[model samples]
Target: MVTLTMDGRKIEAPEGATLLKAANSANIEIPQLCSNEELEHYGACRLCVVEITHKNRTRIVASCIYEVAEGLEVNTRSERVLNVRKLVIELLLARNPRHPSLLKIAEDLGVKKSRFEAEIKGCILCGQCIRTCREVVGVSAIGYEGRGINKRVATPFEESPPDCIACGSCHFVCPVDVIPMKEKDGVRNIWKTDFPLQKCESCGRYFAPVKQLEYFREQYNLPPEQFSKCTHCR
Candidate 1:
């Protein structure tokens, strides 16, 4: 355990723990976005920046990735930090004027109106949806295409890629709800294809994702002897 002082309060934390994780553990309030326990610490939002002083030198750093060193002094809510955060919020607001989450954050930061015109893009490039789809669902169907300011999440050929399993993991993880789910009759529908699930002749068990034994055989390029292994056919 390592002892660190934050905003004049001493707290004990693990040696290698990031400042944000330790603050969260100690119930210290720190505002942040682009941070999730399920994914890596991206530190893209810059909302959790804190002023840290070590040996009388102070600098601003992202708390989500900054390690808590011993005898360190951290100020989570200094005036300078707040001003920087407000400007960050303002810039983000200018980029995504209609985004509800961004609007809410700006409101919380006490931004009345932006002086600069809004650049207005739907997605914030947080990468939450991409990480969730690739890491959790194991489907690399969608990805960020283009470069720099023109970058966006898109399927291959701007159409649904064949590799997509229609898992809906991307939609679930999106913070701004940029990815639109297919809706029918005011209800969002997941991928539901009507495929025959015949009982395996050998095992007499139902396996829906595999569909019929013959269909699985043809799709998987299995040998004829593998028919007995099919739960529906077995």
Candidate 2:
């Protein structure tokens, strides 16, 4: 176990655990995005920055990816750390002023406004959706395109990607709620493509995307009628 002090509270955690993990183990709250316990640590979101002191030196680092070391002192709420985090929140707010999730985080961080001009207006481009799609869903359908001021996420050639299973993984993982998706009249629309909804045979209610069902059917060699009923009905 590695022992560390977070905000002056000593904590013992498993070796190689991240500082964020240590802080969380001690019930120390640190705001973050692009972080999921089930996924690999991605420091794209700068919200988890914390000031650490070791060997008479102090520096700020992203706690989500910073490994905890014995005898290290971590100040999660330091003034410098708060300033950095507030600046990050302000920039995020500037980019996505209307996003509810972003607004909520900004409010929690006491960032009521942004000094920067709005550009792009939404989609902080944290890549949570892209990483979740690639790492968890095993689909490399969506990815970042362009660079610098033109950088953004899009399907291949900015067109409907053939590999997209319409499983809603990207939509579910997006922090800014920018992934386009809507369900209506037993159809699911995503990224300018509409997939028919499959109704549960037993309940007569839409339960799964038709393309997703077909993908499963082909992958598992199941008959067309096999998964007509949803998991609940099965």
Total backbone clashes of candidate 1, pairs 3 or more residues apart or in separate chains: 10
Worst 10 residues of 2 by lDDT: 114-123
Local error of candidate 2 at 91, Å?
0.8
Leading candidate by lDDT: 2
**Model 2: residue 84 alpha-carbon error in angstroms:** 0.5
Write out the backbone clash pairs for model 2: none
Per-residue CA lDDT of model 1 for 148-229, tens digit only, reads 8798877777764655655567777777777766644323333332233334556665333232345446767999667554
Total clashing pairs for each candidate: 10, 0
- State the lDDT at 146 in candidate 2: 93
Candidate 1, pairs of clashing residues:
199-232, 200-232, 200-233, 200-234, 201-232, 201-233, 201-234, 202-233, 202-234, 203-234
lDDT digits (tens) for residues 58-135 of candidate 2: 999999999989889999999999999999988888788888888888888888888788775478878888888888
Q: Which stretches of model 2 miss by more than 4 angstroms?
A: 218-224
Q: Mind sharing the TM-score for model 2?
A: 0.93
